[model samples]
Target: MLLLSRPMAPSNVVLLLIGLHGTGKSTFAKAATGQDVKVNPTGGVDAYTKECNKYTVDFKQRRFIIIDTPGMADQNTIEENLDVLQQVADQLQNLDQERVNGVIYFHSIEGARLSGVDRDNIRILKKICGDEFFPRVAFVTTRWDRIRRSEWDPILVPRNRDLETERMKLLPNGPSIFRFLNDGESHKAVLDYFAGLEDGTAANRGDKKARRSGTG
Candidate 1:
């Protein structure tokens, strides 16, 4: 629910999206590109993304390339997950830029709790980004609109806290959590945050911005 007026980010900013199966990476990708980039419409456990793919969007005088990666599925074996990692590595090696500007990691709030697969996926994500890129990482939780208003305190509040704890473990001192309300403006707010980083205005004040945005 963060409201950011359009951003003036540097052109050709590349972003990497990673998360477990059904976490809404494809949805976010479509939202970022402002188009119906091919994605599995089935909202099921079947893994839709099998490799690294890119989608481009031109907004607010800035160009963004969103790289969506294959996610870990519950049925996947260790080798399969490793293969997914390899796919991402291959994409990175062939990227137009030397490094990705930011990473948008998705999580689903509709799930009752974080499963072991979620934890493993986070570990793999950490390995993918490493310590140096932590500052550029943002954690996005999807499906907020699916939750009812009556459950805000009893359900949503605790889940948000647990997710914040996980984020702190990875980002520690910097600001990072953003809610994906399944809308264009919400998606733009997230991209704007990273774009602000490129403009040098969001570096020191991200904590405040994050605080204002994480109120979902």
Candidate 2:
């Protein structure tokens, strides 16, 4: 689970990546951490990551301790999911900062609508990170590469809007949202937003337009 162990950088940011299975949590973790980091392959219905994983990724002169957690709603029983939630809590508490700098919640644009499982996952995430952390959160939509190039304008834009709107309602104080194309620059766009937050450049609810413009 420890992808890299090295001397800490100047600024160490702890980020929690949360979402359901197949939402590209591991993919992002492996890419951001490094190509050498061994991450579980993404596929199928069941979740491959069974517990919380911690990876150290250096980007733009910042060190990000990414805690990639198990997919919500993958467990058969509510009690089992609760146990995973406890695991996430434990990891957060164990951090040297004892606080998370930001949270990235992933969802696949492939699903046209948010199902019951999706809502349930969001609810569980709220419990894990708490309401005060909402402003530091980013609701990211992934798998844009799956859509055809010709449909990018017509299909991709509107879908992103709908997804953003829907997630806004679920999260309080309006956490910034962005699309993840599964690439490096896109990854930096997300990190840049959180980095801004860390440095006091971005404020919750006030810089919504600035956040969207940075990614757009």
Identify the candidate with maximal lDDT: 1
TM-scores of all candidate predictions against the true structure: 0.79, 0.79
Clashing pairs in 2: none
lDDT at 113 for candidate 2? 68
* Weakest ten-residue segment in model 2 by summed lDDT: 1-10
lDDT of 2 by residue, 94-167 (tens): 65434566778888878776767677767766666567766677888777767776776678667777877788
- lDDT value for candidate 2? 0.67
Off by over 4 Å in 1: 1-10, 75-79, 92-98, 203-216
Local distance difference test scores for all models: 0.69, 0.67
Per-residue CA lDDT of model 1 for 136-199, tens digit only, reads 7787877775667688668876787787777787567445567776745578777777777777
